[model samples]
Target: MEATQILDVARDGILTMVIIAAPVLLAGLTVGLIISLFQTLTQIQEMTLVFVPKIIIVYMAVLILLPFMIQQLVELTERLMDLAISLP
Candidate 1:
């Protein structure tokens, strides 16, 4: 493959990875931020308080988003296979 084709494939792969990861990451981030705010307001500084809620929320988000994530990954794999098959 040409350099541009290679770069394009790499870029797409990275973007797909980001897209797949974004929901879970964002859910964790948002849960953590909210938990931090609650802790600040309540003056509670328990380390497990932050971790458990974030983990649960992220896991729930992953479960809810699993189908979409799988679809995106499958599409990406198909596109990659097509490119590989067409490559010189």
Candidate 2:
């Protein structure tokens, strides 16, 4: 592959990864922030309190987003394969 083509593929892969991960990451961040706020207000600083809800919410977000993530990955793979087949 040409340098530009390689770079394009890499960029696309990274972008796809970030797009796929964003929902779960954002959900985790939101849950953590809310828990932190609650802890601050209540003067409760249990570490598990912060971790458990974030993990559950992020897992739920991942489950909800799994289909879309799979579609994006399949599309990216198909495009890369097509590019490879067309390459000299």
Candidate 3:
């Protein structure tokens, strides 16, 4: 494959990955922010307070967004396959 085609594929793969990961990452970020704010307000500085909630939220987000993630990945794969088939 030419460099441009290779770059395009790489870009597509990266964009797809980012799209798939955004929901989980955003969920974790939102939970962490809220926990931090609560701790600041209440003065309860428990370092481990963030982990469980963040993990649970992220896990739930993943579970909920799983289908969308899979669809994005499948689309990326199909595009790559099409490109390969058309290449040679």
Tens digits of per-residue lDDT, candidate 3, 41-86, equal 9999899999999999999998899989989988998998898889
Give RMSD (Å) of candidate 3 vs. truth. 0.6
Candidate 3 stretches with Cα past 4 Å from truth are none
RMSD of each: 0.9, 0.7, 0.6
Among these predictions, the greatest lDDT belongs to 2
Give per-residue CA lDDT, model 2, range 1-88, as digits (tens). 8999999999999999999998889999999999999999999978889888888898899899999999999999999999999999
The TM-score of candidate 1 is 0.94
Clashing pairs in 2: none
Q: lDDT for every model?
A: 0.92, 0.93, 0.92
Residue 15, candidate 1: alpha-carbon lDDT: 97
Candidate structures ordered by TM-score, highest first: 3, 2, 1
TM-score of each: 0.94, 0.96, 0.97
Model 1, runs deviating above 4 Å: none
Model 2 lowest lDDT segment of ten: 45-54
lDDT of 1 by residue, 1-21 (tens): 899988988999999999999
User: Alpha carbon lDDT of residue 46, candidate 1?
Assistant: 89
